[model samples]
Target: MRTPTRFKAGAVILSAVALTVTACGTGGGDTSGGATADAGSGTGEIKVWGHQGEEGEVAALQAAVAGFNSSQKGVKATLQLIPSADYTKTVSATSPDQLPDVLEYDGPLMASFAYDKKLAPVEGLVSAQTIGNQTDSVKTQNTYQLDKKLYGVSMYDSGLGVYGNKALLDAAGVTYPKGLGDAWTADQFQTALEKLAAKDPDQKVLDVKENYGGEWPTYGFLPIVNSAGALAIKDNKAEGNLNSAPVVKAVQQFAGWRKFVDPNSDDKAFTDGRVALSWVGHWQYNPYNKALGQKLVVLPLPDFGAGTKSGQGSWAWGIGGSSKNGKAAGLFLDYLLNDSNVTAMTTANAAPPGTKTVIATDPLYKPGGPLQLFADGLSKTCGANPPTTACVATPRPVTPAYPVFSQQFSQAFLNIYKGGDAQAELDKAAKAIDQDFTDNNNYTS
Candidate 1:
């Protein structure tokens, strides 16, 4: 899902190659201050940066920063909005003088920056104890990291799920699957799709051309692989487990369902009232609600088997390593991550709350709502933890070279859907991924 916020201020659009910076460098030396500058005596200015998009979101962040600045007598915080697409480029290029004291970073980019030493270890500022008191999924995605170092804190959690149009199910006289308890197996899911297809052979029930990049598939289809007990990448090695018996069976099942999906359809295939269900993220709540004008029933993505490790995804906040006012920035980070602030951000973003406390109490999470079901699924079935490296075994990676990786994965999947050999395409893609890690010195093994 697109972050509702983006960088405002002056934005400089760049060609695909060169890194770009937005705001002109404001002349000011680093104002050195103690890490524990008392709120009453802390006298310095701290600049905060984040993606600027939705007006309400930007205003909310600005208000939070303002509250922090006003709550203290000694320090002031300045807010700088950056466009989401250009944030990484701007953050990477800016010197200490121009970078913000604190930043809201995309989770996937955190590892790349941390690996490059562009971000500071936040362990000293926030403790596991503090995070533990928040949401389980939020803490799991944020605190768990590569090399056992805590580099980011998540403000919201997002995951993929099947959004069923209850009206469509009712019209077709099909019973909506129970929560995760009755989650369908791969065959069951395909059977349901085939039934839906047969019910209206003239129309599609799902869209097959949707992008499978990153967590969308992890949330939508990885559970199938996991249920099959298929190993994606074990011990940092490429495993063609995708071609293994269980996985192959799952893939074949998916291909069967493709018959009922219109290859040319877009998300509107469901959102525009053309299909029975759509694979989407929790963040799509607002747009979906706005379009449907009623609550959509969400079902736990069906499992391929009886596996316990369901894949999930998250977005996090990180601090820049080059910031001169590291302490002030850390303080601001702590404040923004407080339970209340995290809940506010997650709710505003229309995503699942990261903390357990909020998940238990957020009004949006009614007992039978889709959000609550997602939260339960997260608690019972999410994977061990996300990989700290740039690329993962399945879906894709979050490295600096993600553009190239995504392009390759997209092409390979398109080929597979068009009658190309799944093994051949995956093998070719795996070799490319291995080469990417080797060439970039990202391979750990």
Candidate 2:
């Protein structure tokens, strides 16, 4: 059995989730504290796990749960919001029978859970047509296939969009990259970086957020490689694809930003006027809007020879493989996905909606809204392919071996940014990833 390791926001895990159809008499709902807690009043325990630490998102979820609780005389669920540090290990360490009824997990890592039978096949529980109705990006992130069985459905979605500080750009006397296009060419991007750096010799010009380790590198840097025309993994091939000449050139180009990048910088750096350009997502929109006002702009990742790309996928919900109450849990999952609840979560999180219907009505994502750029969910397979000049995202590669792929790729990026050989590091990472594919039987397609 694979050991569940801690998720550093980059790591992923697998789970099995189910719901019980039977309804027990109503009882007072109780909060589950650390380790474990009482099941409360229900047919049986329907424990739901989430990892949102923010007060706003937590309150939003609690509100949704409260609604679920009031709507039923059965299946009172306790939302055990764990700290991210303790989350993955808690889920992985618990035996199948001990696992929670439902899991709120990072979408990218759902494959690992599916591979290990942590997630029950959701195909029969939810209709194929209903699942199909989800936005392409949201659907792709939560879907996990193993021997042709899909494991789960996402409750919501989130993605990153490149953002620029117009004031900083003007200070540097450079024009912001146009939205609705494939982003700037490599030379154009470099020229902009140079201009920004030159304008503030003592201040950092770019914040690639290298200080964030683990899965972040894959999410933050993989798009650059994708835009350079490389697939982290494709057609059971890893070596050539990840180590392609174009991919290496992209890494080289990113490394070239070393002089302008500040690894030690935090999110406030961009909003505080320390950096001219950076990568952030919708969650920061409120504070960013408050900080920079009209000067803040969402942008697409600059294209290399290909097109723009950026990261996608965020927290998603799934049923545990051994939940005693599969039907009830499924119902809760469905409740969480309801338009009103989904809107509540999106509104609280300040993120793009996970489904098209929600986005259609969401004022935040409506045309001319601050988050409209990210609301598009990126064009072309969640960054799996080169997209148009449109500021849509190119999400990270989805695979059962993502944890390993992310770890190795993260290390390699660290090396390249610190003056290590780009081709050599990527080549090494690719070899390791390909071997993992073979060991895992190419995810047993």
TM-score for each candidate, following the candidate numbering:
0.78, 0.85
User: Please, what is the whole-model Cα lDDT of each candidate in the order they appear?
Assistant: 0.54, 0.66
Best-performing candidate as measured by TM-score: 2
Candidate 2 — what's its lDDT?
Answer: 0.66
Query: Tens-digit lDDT track for model 1 on 1-445?
Result: 3321221111112223322121111112111111121222224887777876466656667777777887776667788887755665676565544555567665544444554445666666555555565555544444323454566676656555677877877777767676666666666777677667767756588753253333232234544555566544443333464345666565556655666775432446666777787765565666677777664777656566543233444556666666666656667776776666766675666666656666677666647664676666556533343322121212223343343343344455556656777777667766765565565544221
Per-prediction RMSD in angstroms? 6.9, 8.3
